[model samples]
Target: MRSEFCNALVGRSGNENVLFMTGDLGYMALEPLQEALGERFINAGVAEQNMISVAAALSRQGFEVWAYSIAPFCYARPFEQIRNDIAFNDLPVKLVGNGGGYAYGVMGPSHHAIEDYGVLLTLPNMRVYAPVFNEDISAVVNCLSSELRPSYLRLGRGEAPDGYVIPQYAAWRQLTYGDGIVIIAVGPLASTYIGAFEKLPKTQRPNLWAVAQMPISANPLPSELLSQISSAPALCVAEEHVKRGGFASELALYLAEGGKMPKQFRHHYALAHTYGTYGSQQFLRSLSALDEGTLLSTIAEFAPTSV
Candidate 1:
């Protein structure tokens, strides 16, 4: 995906408007970017704050700047830089971070970016986009090209799940439609819900929505989509990240404000209270109860009855 992003950026050469900067981390993959756009690409070493500041300054000068790094190092460590320099000024800087959540599983807590969404969503002008698949990534890249505000795109480490083919860069996508229950799954975890759906009888399947771009500034809850979900007897949200202030929490608040209370609303996300020791992503997911089996159990337990 990094290669794809770099290739896309390099293809925009003669325009002289696009600038790509890295924290001296994309040595192997980003060589093409540096070679093609040498004057534009700046390797600012491991200093994420300095990288963000420079990107913001470049944006102020009317250049499209993209800053790349690992998720935690890029956002959590240099949060002040993002909030003050880029977000406060509403600069058009594209902050792309790899290894979201347990994508860096074996690397442990220091590398795990489980709280990135929670943190980024709190910033006033920052827009967050997490694609579930490669196609969605392409769509987001296209969408970002036209965006005017500061945006953060969180990319995964491994291959993305095949949820749905998103032709456009909409904030959300409804993959399945049903009346009994509504399930909102964020990022690659949407595929888990899809897997769970296959385990159910056709009549037992609930409505499912895949959120491609979860932007902080943008209320992704379109009225039409919300209305459809509101009609359901229950709602459930699934994510690989922590439950607190993540997608589930945000959607719950939105539903509360809309005055559409489901029979039972549940969150099947990572437990924010505990951070596990280093392990494979699968082991960490199982340990945190963010795996498919747990999700399936949660859905079965919360099966809605006609109101």
Candidate 2:
């Protein structure tokens, strides 16, 4: 994703207002950007809070700025600075969080960024995005080019594409048509669910949606996506993060508060607590029962409530 960001930066070389800041990470993926942009790219030496302040100040100067760092440091370490300097002031600072959603599986809970979405979603006028496909990077960078307010771009590790065209919005990218069920996958989980779903016979498969961006407003509701989801008889949310305050929790809360809760709902997410074990991304997912085998089992046992 950092590579894509740099490529987009080069594409916008004529725009002198663009600048990039890093928190002493992305040594491998960021060097290309540095070579291309020269002094426009900055390395802030692991001081995340200071980086956020600097980015906000730069934005005040009528520059379009983006701060880059690991998931934990990018948003969590400098949270207070971000809330005040960026969101409160309504600056056009863009924050890029790499290695989100267990992308750093071996780094333990301290490196995990399960709560990033929930935390940033609460801030006023903050837009949150996560790409499921390589093509999705264009929309993300275009966001940098055109966003009028503060925005956060959540990214996974490596460069795996979703193997499908990324739609501009989640609801509009209906992967299938059916009233039986709606399975929505956000971030890298899209590939996992897509691969697992192939094992099921056509008779039991449900409708599918690849949710690329979080439609969070002051109301904190996904009302637009829900309008599309309402057509299904049941709904399921899949995410690499824990259920608490993640996509599923957010969706459920929105529906309940608005008095439009879906009667038949199911969600596949990480456990509320991790064992603190370390391994590759896929291994960690398996330990928490977010694997393809688990999905198959759940599908076989699914009752599909009548509500």
Candidate 3:
């Protein structure tokens, strides 16, 4: 996802008003951007808060500013500056957060960003984007480039299955259709669901969808998603982040408000128990029941009973 995002940044090299600033990170990965962008690329040392303040000021001065860092450093570290300087003023500052969720596994809770989107969304005029596949990065970058509000792009590794052609990126994408259950995977966790889908037989698969944008907007909800949820016997939301104020909570609230709640809704997310433990991302996901194996077992429960 980092490489894809850098490529996207390089693609925007012609835009003189655009700037990419990082907090002393991106050692090897950002050289292309630095070379392409020339003086427009900035390394703000280890000062995440100061980097954000400067970026916000640059945006206020009509520059398209994108501040980059690890997930926690990008948003959590300098949250007040983001809220007051960017969101309060409604500045068009793009924040690129690499290693979202537990991607920086074994680094402990301080590095994990399970609540990044939830916190950022609470601010005024802030948009959260978590692209589900590598192919979605370019489209997401394009969206952020033109977005008028302070926005955060949570980066995670995602790849589509071989021979499966992903459609052009959108806020909501129906990856597959089935009758028994509606499976909604947010961000790179969609890859886990996709792996589970491939392992299951056609009769056991669920209606699968991937969501990229956050702060659920149900104003004329996507008819396809609405129909899938309206008819499926069960609905499940899979995300790497915590349940509260994340994708699952927002989706549930919006569905209930619209009177389109499913009969059985389950949320699989990063559990608090794992906050005290450290391991690889896959290991952490297994503990949180967000891995492919756990999903396969969970989906089986929602399968149609034999006649």
Candidate 4:
């Protein structure tokens, strides 16, 4: 997905007003963009706050600016600048964060962005985008390009099942429709569910959906998704991010407010912080029970009938 984002940025480099600025990161993955963007590409050293401020300034001058860095650096490190200079002013500055969730596994919590979008979403004018598949990058880039507000693009791992046609990108789009449990996956974690779901028989498989955008109020949840939630016998929401301010939390609020809770509801997400351990993303996900095996088990448990 990082490579896809670089390619998308390079593809958009023809626009002189569009610029990409990184915080001395993106060593190999960003060569294409650097070459295509030329002087328009600025490596702002390791100063994330300054990078965001510069991007905001460029945006104020009518340029479409993107501040690039790893997920934590992009949002957590320069949060003050992001909130004041970009989001508060409603500048059209795009914050491109790579390695969302624990994608930078083994690098430890410093690189993890489990709380990134949740924190950014607090800004009233900020829009958060979490593309569920690599193929969604171009559409997401184009969508951000069309908007003139602060936005965050969280790049993570995702891919569609072979030969499966993903519908046009939307805030909420159904991947597979079935009875019983309605499974909702947020961001790149959608891939985890996509692969694990094949284990279940078609009769017991749940309806699958992915959420690509945030601040759900902006785009509004599709009526189809709402109807699925209402009718399904069980509901499960999974995400790499923590529960608070994430899809599950927001959706729960929506359901509770509307008095439409399902019979059985479960949320699989990054659990309590790992204070003394470090490993690969999959390793940590297993600890949180967010891995494929756990997902399959959960689905079987949630399914109306045995597989």
Provide the overall lDDT of each model, using Cα atoms, as 2-decimal numbers. 0.75, 0.73, 0.87, 0.85
**Could you tell me which 10 consecutive residues in candidate 1 have the lowest summed lDDT?**
158-167
What digit string (tens of lDDT, one per residue) describes model 4 on residues 108-150? Answer: 8889989888889989788999998898998899999988789
Candidate 2 C-alpha error for residue 239, in Å: 1.4
lDDT of 3 by residue, 1-307 (tens): 9999999999999999989999989988989999999999999999998999999999999999999999999999999999989999999999989999889888788888898998899898788899989888999999999998889999998888887788789888878755658888888888666755866677778878888887776223488888878887789999888888888888888889889999899999988634556898888988899998887777889888889
lDDT score, candidate 4: 0.85
Return the TM-score for each candidate structure.
0.89, 0.87, 0.96, 0.95
As for model 2, its CA RMSD to the true structure in angstroms is 3.3
Candidate 2, 101-192: lDDT as tens digits: 87788878778787888788778888777877555676668865688888888887423334644355332255544334667777766755
Return the TM-score for candidate 2, rounded to 2 decimals: 0.87
Pairs that clash in candidate 1: none
Alpha-carbon shift of residue 136 in model 1 (angstroms): 1.3
Considering every candidate listed, which one attains the maximal lDDT? 3
Candidate 3: clashing pairs of residues:
none
- Shift of residue 74 alpha carbon in model 3, Å: 0.4
Predicted candidate 1 versus true structure: per-residue lDDT over 45-90, tens digit per residue:
8889899999999999999888999888889888999999998998
- Any runs in candidate 2 off by more than 4 Å, and if so which? 157-172, 177-179, 218-233, 272-274, 303-307
